[model samples]
Target chain A: MIRRGGRRGGVVAAGLLTGALLGLGFPAPARADPEADRIGFRSYFQQRFPDVPAEAWIDGMYAIDEGARQQWQEIEDFPPYEFTVEEGQALFQDPFGDGRSYGDCFPDAGRGIRQRYPRFDSETGEVETLEVAINGCRARHGEPALSYDSKEMLALTAWIAYASRGRPMAVEVPDDARALAAYEEGKRFYYTKRGRLDMACVDCHGRYAGAFIRGDHLSASLGHPTHFPVYRLKLGGMVSLHKRFHGCIRDVGAEPFDEQSREFRRLEYFLTYMSNGLEANGPAVRK
Target chain B: MRDVVTSALVLAACLALPVARAADDSRTPAVEGVLAAVESLRAQAVTAGHEWLGTRSLLDEARAAAASGDAARALELAEQARRDCELALEQARREEEAWQGRVLR
Candidate 1:
């Protein structure tokens, strides 16, 4: 009887050991530490490209690819976005039907303020994007909201981005539960795999940054938000950040969230926060 | 006379089998059932916020096939859509916890 009991005890111990070994394949629950995450995120890229300075990330693929940089410099010389910027300036100066201009709705007359976007609204318990704020301004002045992808909207954002050319990204996640939740949700969205391709944002931008996909080199996620509302030669027009997000999602075989939707807004909030110190360099040209 | 009748009946039965099989080829009810299942799965995937880009287009194609009386084609498209939704939902479930591991820290 003693020998039989010993054998049973040995079997139970072996089962427990096997279970523990299998558990190693799964991830442990991570503690929420935004600062630590930011440090690790920056460190990964810094280590990957030891030659590139941290600030140079704002130039995106141009910072890494020498050939692309030369071509981009040539394009910048004759900046195609000049016309759009002028149109945006005209729209900004023109008064609404209510005799109030777009400047009447924003602080600093809406100049040099692109970096303060994707802000947390304490009252609404949600993230508010620059586009959403622009629409809010329109509504207040009894004007119709522009479509998120409209030429007018792109022009306005391009001008705002141009105005704040050298300002650093200053997105802040307030010390509130809702704000933290939004940030966490956005982070999850960034890492979560979706679509037929089963790829996440991190797979391309994080894991394979500076790598060539066909003719296009993938840019690091570190300073992705800094240069947006970009004029793309392929598109022959200006494209907003959210529009790029839509394209990325679709490229991965995932249905994208609507432009300026809650999901995209939260994503923008989280992404902008990741580039907190990068200078805003938008209304730029791209391939 | 009885033998002759039996032979004729066997020939008729064999001929009728093809006709019955032809009717089964356009099984509209089967296509409808598959489409229904695909829709339910698609809804779950959409709710989970992991719907694939091709799922909706496949579902639309299935509906068009069904309207055009191509039951076999409709069922094929619906099944493809159903598989897409199932994979998306599985992805959603796996990523729910797994995403934390991919975080930079």
Candidate 2:
């Protein structure tokens, strides 16, 4: 199933070399221009699907898959994630044994703030995901931190993402050197080939995006951040971003990184930034 | 005369082929040693928290081959598994630093 032919080895090296050369040639040297990358990324997808509106991409492959789009539309009529969202709302309001609530931990009680997460915390010199921030709040409140890939965490995130629905993704890769380094690290992770399959995220979702792999259509990476904590019918459960990352890595035969690992946090940081300006639509149903 | 030389060459190659095969057959199989090396690397990968699934599958196949008494096949598989695990370990190490080189500008 691993397609090895065409555009594998030298393409990655060429990209790296080109970037390095460009960095050296620039007057004010910077490792990357997120703005330029954003323009290019959006343009590529736009050119690929001239008819599909930018906002429609939040639906992922359904933007391209007509049949799946119909099914997804039907499924969304009575969304499967409603129960989980209700549970998340209940959990959010429920106070810890210490008598404080999840609201106290976040700005605006975490309302409409999903866009700002996976932020570079200058204090910690690491990317802070929503899951990490949630657990941090729990620990501070003398409550147990939930597992990054647990149903509780997913439910909580689904609620938060629901709260932020229609809010644009606004993740920042801060100007700090540490933050920049983390962003670059995430960019590297995205492009690097691994596993016996020797595939990078770019190979499928980047280059051959919209191309079919067996029965599944590869979704472009641009709008990946829009819909998350998705209710996957195949999985018959909610899937967190970290869980999806694990599955994708394992799909290519690579060892899955630990959930909420530094590498994963960085990846989330980069990916969410890529989807900046896209409206958050979560607790989404997916096939 | 040309035919005679051609015939002689063929006869010589035929004689040498079995000798080479016999030499290969005479050497001690390296399967056990290679399998051990692969297992060691697998343990290291586990400690590093980056064990590759392919490494385990290849090692399992090598073990099965060994159990079936196909030393040559076992040796080949074991050597492959060893190389795979070694590469996996190296990948984990190299990415620690090499990731920086690929940052998009």
Candidate 3:
């Protein structure tokens, strides 16, 4: 009887082991450390392109495109995004309906804070992007929030990015489980293949970085977040990062979620956090 | 003898023509069924917020082949579209449960 009871216990233990193995193959990862992920992410890019200077990554596609580099240099002489920056400066200082300005809502009067954006907001238990934070500030002042991809918001972020230029990105992923979960979701979104093309974000920016495809060089993902609200000569206008996300997913023939959705917000949080040390070099011109 | 041969030859040609045409026309209902399945699968994918990828383009090509009277080609394209939509639906369902395994930790 003791032997039979022992045999039954062994079977139960074996069943539990099998279930644990199956769980590892499916749901939430057991190990989730932001610092480890960041280190691994940077190391992967550095190992792939050992010759490219770390700082040069800020130039994005131009880090590999010589011709574009020259054109980008020329464009910088009189940057096309200059006018939008000026417009944003005006908007930043202008008061809302209650005569309270955007400066009143942020640390240091919203002077130089672009690099710390797409933060994991513990209070909300979600990732909050710069756009959302900006809108939140307006909402607190009894003003209607601007559109996620609006011209005004683009200009506003451009102004903020310009103000924060040269400051290193310092996004933080807290010790909280929700913050780690948000980052993990973004990482999954980055690597997961979707659409008929069966492509992930890593397929281009991670795997094919510096390779030219159809008259364009694939930029490394390492410093992709550094330059947003970029003036694209191809589009003849400034394009926001969330807009770029939508365009890329569509390029693979996938249906994209709306900009500022939870998926995208978490994606932004992960990417911005990954670019922790890169300088904020936005309102820049791009091909 | 010459008249008999010519008349027999003409009779043979008439009988063969309908048989070949019937063979082609026989594929029409099967193609139509697959096309309907593509739409139904696409609806499922959309409800799940999954992208149907090139399914729509494949469906369009299938209709174009049908319009051009190529029953075999139409059937082939429609079947491909149906398969792609089904795959998309499967991918959507699997990702909901499996995306975590691929996460960088």
Candidate 4:
């Protein structure tokens, strides 16, 4: 269950989105004020759920502990993190389907504007959104493929999300029957109960979106993904979508999906599509 | 889908109901756990008290969860019951040794 705090506080935020999109109407968050940076968002969340582990809420968007390396703390390295960022930058720089980079496609790879995902693609005849397009770029360009659920891909994806920071998520399914079908399919996935607890993703996040779960406040999933690649407290660094999905399942004692399993991808498609109008703030942190 | 949230919670409660029953029956899982932990400590006898305390807290939390209307939440809390007791047993052993050594000194 992703919460909606810490600039779309992962599951906490995800929960809110889940509830709202499912037609479970809870109050959407008030519009973010000008000072609505990750820190402010996090502070507001902490006030609401003080019991959540303090470490769980630390923002991971900034460069990891350069000072630690400056000293001698023997910090764990994230060369892969840098590599993933490079990959994302490349995609942003050159998603050239017709010899045109994304810079040429939609200026700035559509930076600071995450409000355009889950859109219907008339040409593709599918609801290909941000991730789908990125993967398509990989396929058409003969780039090494990245799984939708892979951390390698997600880190890059998070950077794309980062590029779109401050932009509202503006996903809109076409009113066509097929698009409606996809939205309904996503809705079905969200409401279905799975896992050992017989819990669905909605159990904690939806029902208790603003309530306490152990030491943490349950975040609504409404605006999830606003800040991702968020530093997971227990994980000790930024994590990807699939990792968060696995975490939710584990907490419910459910069987987690294979790294790129269809069930997981379908769920991702559904969830991300639903969060159509929130911003993307990646490489953040949460409890 | 207002039902999505509550319905899911209801289902979770159902999944966890049996565990609450298990938690209540001391002769069942909880006691068995405490016995296993105490038995382990009797040999080392080093951290018995701590283990006992840990188990106590775990059991308390488990009992609290089991007592909740949401059975799934209870069972989820229950699973930790055994471990918490085990930790307390360890802590007890450490405390006992400290006390004894001080008296001797």
Candidate 5:
């Protein structure tokens, strides 16, 4: 269910002109249908890169770039994230002071559940990301919440992601008004220009996906959330999806929201939903 | 008469120097006011979730400049920061509707 009217043509023309004048980039007039949005979003990328298979989007930039794909295939031979995944597995199984572990709070002992994250918790009436859930679990059990950037949190997410590899992304935008509003807000955040650079997420990932920006290929937004807790060669460490969001926001000259912040959680919710059928292949390597 | 004229000019110049310095010192309060304006706008931007990077830093730098008695520099930085905040607020408002256009169909 979409909340806004689908006015077309003139709105698009005016939007383009305004965007050009503002240097913020153009957008289609608003549509509120979540399923339609997902389809349109996916179709845009699919049409743009016909040769790439739908499932390959999990590879991100590598899915479209042949040379980079070859290099990435080689990197996969000896994935740098191996140790982190092991560490995460240990952390996952380690019990809290009450002798109950992180796995106790999640379904299936927290195995193979990464794809269902950034869920809309109706009770809280807010987007509850896996990170938030993890922290909440800690709070409920009388344990201190781990910082989003803490090694233990990163490791735990990495292991969970590893466990969920190959499962398709399954984020849902419930029919409730608050849920829809949250989704809409996330969509707006993706397109809206913020920061000193005056660039929106759409400007780079939508308008210029597959284009080289300073020798780095911009990945399509379609499968952005399929992979997370990526080990970046540049950072020589693992970073969760929200951490990546924070960095991208900062890169655009905006003051970033905190990790697992409501803004970021909403963003993750919208972004992950866009990749509804893409397989989760996290704890992946990136340049 | 020429010597008298030269001495008179020198004395006048000496007296006027302090007056000029006093006038310049008076600008400190004006710069502080600009800094305050920048801070207010920055808070608004932050509230709107549109605060730009470097705005806070610019405000800090302006305060530092004011503390160091560089009224001109302080004014310049404060004005720049204020402009940044204003632009951010404008962006936030513009995006309210413009974001719809950017959505994928």
Candidate 6:
């Protein structure tokens, strides 16, 4: 089940698909429009939940909960947490009607399958996350496409997410013609000012990263996405990569993104490219 | 004499528990101030050896409830969120330091 899939063969499929999409679609849209300046950071903290526990706010009785630092450390098992790896491993082995398993689709060569994701696939000129690739795997095997947010995918993705853990994110906006094009689009998005503050992401995370806003200090976006499926304290639950992007855009005073919007995926690609070389901190603990 | 000691202990606990007085006095200003301060620290994203973001954020919400005149909520949230934030902050700080060290290298 844990078999081989080469890298060279997918280029043909990608090229054909990219060409077809561009053939009929409208031209690329304008960059993000500016939003008004609203000065409040509560959405990051407020709307996520209500009513905290008693130990969280007692006067001078903080030792009641804040005392143990090691108590909450997540234990990393060899296989990682979640249940879908078993299914994915199974699918990897089962052969399709053409006697082609998912592994057979790839050219016979090599792959750093888990380490490279949110990758810049030059053949199609598209930025692909692991979730996209998994569906690609499904389509290659002639299986029905899985939803991007499905639990099966989330679990399999989580395992793959686990696979990428220690690897430095190698994604790059190539200096060559194709990569340069995508990079330009992304750069325009990053610096071109958007939403309420008329503030671009560069303004705060870039210029004012360490500055204090109200009470909490702002973190620099550098090395930000080292973890995935991070345990968010705000929602009292776990949140995924794009969800964070959605929150950040909303916080900027623009309308939140539809979770699966191409705009978001492009933004995610650009952002991920920006933080390249940083290891994934997915399945992390965020305040 | 026994009655006097019991009364003294009860008085100390009363001062300690806002809800002990009115069962609704959960917004301890002192605690809220620190919680807010911790949140500020979290945004700095230089979490120390602790993981307190959740605790701090949760505490703020609870404090709001208490301040809105719900002593019961204030007391409950104060205790729980405080514990979570404190520990979380410490963990975050430690990890942040380690992460920065790696980055700086």
Winning model by DockQ: 5
Compute each candidate's TM-score over C-alphas: 0.85, 0.76, 0.76, 0.47, 0.85, 0.47
What would the per-residue lDDT of candidate 6 be over residues B1-105, giving only the tens digit for each residue? 999999999998878776444533344565456556645644433222122224445666766775676665665676675555544445444433332222110
Candidate 2 C-alpha lDDT tens digits along A1-287: 13453456567779888887778675555566666767776877788778988788888999899998998899999999999998898899899999999999876766898888889888988999999999999999999989877878888999999999989999887678898889877777887767767677877887788999999899988778778899999988999888888899999878888889898888888888888999998879987
Clash count per candidate = 0, 2, 0, 60, 4, 70
lDDT of 5 by residue, A171-254 (tens): 988889899999988888999899989999989998899999998899988888988989999999898888899999999999
Native contact share for candidate 4? 0.00
Q: What stretches of model 4 exceed 4 Å from their correct place?
A: A1-87, A94-107, A110-113, A122-126, A149-152, A258-262, B1-105
Which residue pairs clash within candidate 3? Answer: none
Which 10-residue window in model 6 chain B sums to the lowest lDDT? B96-105
* TM-score for candidate 6: 0.47
TM-score of chain A of 2: 0.89
Share of real interface contacts recovered by each model? 0.86, 0.31, 0.41, 0.00, 0.80, 0.00
Model 1 alpha-carbon miss at residue B102, Å: 1.4
* CAPRI quality of model 1: medium
10 residues in a row with least lDDT, candidate 3 chain A: A23-32
Kindly indicate the candidate among 1 and 4 with the higher lDDT.
Answer: 1
Query: What's the i-RMS of each model?
Result: 0.9, 3.4, 2.8, 20.7, 0.8, 16.6
Kindly report the docking quality category of candidate 5: medium
TM-score of chain B of 5: 0.73
lDDT of 4 by residue, A1-287 (tens): 23334555666678877977667766664332212222343444355456653233222212123342333222224423445566667756654445655454355665764456556676755666556666676666566666765655666666676677666555665656666565544444455554335455655654455565665456654456455555555655567665777777766644455433444545555666545444565545454
Error of 3 at A148 (Å): 1.7
Q: What TM value does the first chain of each candidate achieve?
A: 0.88, 0.89, 0.90, 0.60, 0.88, 0.60
Residue by residue across A223-275, what tens digits does model 1's lDDT show?
Answer: 88888889989989999989888999999999999999888898888888888
TM-score of model 4 (CA atoms): 0.47
Clashing pairs in 2: A31-B105, A32-B105
**Over the stretch B1-105, how does candidate 3's per-residue lDDT look in tens digits?**
999999999999999997667456745677677777777888888777576557778878887777666777888887887787878887777777565554332
Name model 3 segments beyond 4 Å from true.
A1-29, B1-49, B53-82, B93-105
